[model samples]
Target: MLKFSILKCLPVLAVCALLAACVGPQKQTAGYDYTAFKSAKPRSILVLPPLNETVDVNATNGMLSQMTMPLAESGYYVLPVAEVAETFRQNGISLPVEMQATSPKKLREIFGADAVLYTKVTQYGSVYRVVDSSTVVTATAKLVSLGTGDVLWQGGASANGKELGNVDFGSGSIIGMMVQAAVKQVAHSLADKSQEVAGLTSQRLLSAGQPNGLLYGPHSPKYGSD
Candidate 1:
């Protein structure tokens, strides 16, 4: 009694399922230990506005928003944007009315974050269009120790946009929809990345026996095994 309409969404559903499968059960890193960071829970943390550096000016918001969801989902107390903004103001960093990116030092001073996460967009929009719709976006995120500037954790993710078969959706109104679809796709990947980062960061903190003040959830068991 299955209708064609039900069958029609099979690919979309299948892709969505596969996307999680691909990111989940991810390869766990080996020989990592943590003991230092868990002693003091990460009371408040801040994600600096990602550097756009992309062909698209709006790319920064996409990453920032995506990054927030995973961390918030994991249960850490996140610093409010307004507070971070105010901190920036007091520090003498003049952010444009529309700007929201956070600087490293400013993040430390404003949120008193034990660590700061910095992200740089390495690839965005499209560079070569002949083969596919320049719909793939990638970013490199690094967690730096506020005390030493040492990178505590690092991860990256790439999102694939909606495709109407072989035709690129990059030409019209569909572009906006495609961009949104891409963000959703990327959000899942970034969530996985966040899980992995949190897991690994936990291990690092636990191994060091130092309370680094941040904790990623155990949902990502791969972080512990690796």
Candidate 2:
């Protein structure tokens, strides 16, 4: 009888094992090749002004201000963004696209930077739903070798701000609720909460030692360890 009971439990145990395997974390691949990165060992990075692809015109500069700290904290010298912008303007390059389109060789000659970080802000704004409103920011960054123009590393991050709760209009008229929602939307817009979200996104993309993230730079204590 004991043997028969054990036999009966075999199927249940097998199912549990299968379910556990299905829920387990899958292995991750380090998507970038770091051969050139380690070989060059770049020490300074120039961050170009971000190209804004979203509807918000303020997204570009708002996101740009948040990038330098993370790169500097990750053990690289970041050129002063304001100075870079002024230089570009004096040279007749007024837009991010134009700056990015400038030849990599010319960039190396002009800035003496070891690498350049190009970024794009694809999403930045408050999105409204019936019950709540949330601000979302998404961005992608690529580190390119100034000497060779080869892409050394690429990563992206996205963040959403805490959702604002809807005003409860219990048993209110439809028109009244609509007006309330409109007012809430306007108030949220005035807050510009997306700027906060953009800061978090920039940090995640530029900080090192995260899984599939950037390798530690030469100045970091963990420099050669990554």
Candidate 3:
């Protein structure tokens, strides 16, 4: 009986070993390569108006307006956006696509910036469902060296108003949920909550200090620490 019991335990141990082998050590994620970005070490960033891929006409301006604060906070000098837009307009380069297409050398000469940030708005505005509604904003950005025209860094971020924990319709009847969703949709549209969400997205996309985020600019207190 003792021998049989030991044999049974051996099989159980073998199964556990196999299971452990199957669940091996977690793979570490590869860190972003910042070689180019580190080499460039830009001091000033010129943000061009974001290209709007969405149907919302306000997406470009909304995303553009929110970009400056975060980049400035990251310790880089952000050229005044209003002035930049007007400069483009005066030169007959009113479209974001055209602005982005302008040669990096020309941009350096015109704006006297060390680098330029190009952005695109992929999603914006509120979407309505039968029992739920939410505002979402998504964007991607790239930093390029004005001198070399090499891409220094790139990242993307998104924000949803519902996920931000600000939306609440209460746990109520289905009819009540529908009504609340409708009312919330109308309120969100009127309030243009997508712009608010864009602010959050811009912070995530441009802010330094976070893992895989932009390197700190010279203006930041932690500039060299990164």
| Top-lDDT candidate index | 3
How much lDDT does each candidate structure score?
A: 0.51, 0.84, 0.91
Better of 2 and 3 by TM-score: 3
Task: Give one digit per residue, the lDDT tens place, for model 3 in 99-180.
Answer: 9999999999999999999999999998788888889899999999998999999999999887666668786889999999
* Tens-digit per-residue lDDT, 3-113, candidate 2: 999999999999999987776644223256688888878899999999999999989998998998888888899999989999999999999999988887999998999
Backbone collision count in every prediction?
19, 0, 1
lDDT of 1 at 21: 81
Off by over 4 Å in 3: 1-29, 163-165
TM-score of each: 0.50, 0.78, 0.84
Q: lDDT per residue, candidate 1, 165-217, as tens digits? A: 22333444655666745654455344433323323322332221123323453
Q: TM-score: which candidate is best?
A: 3
Worst 10 residues of 3 by lDDT: 22-31
Measured with C-alpha atoms, the lDDT of residue 132 in candidate 1 is 29
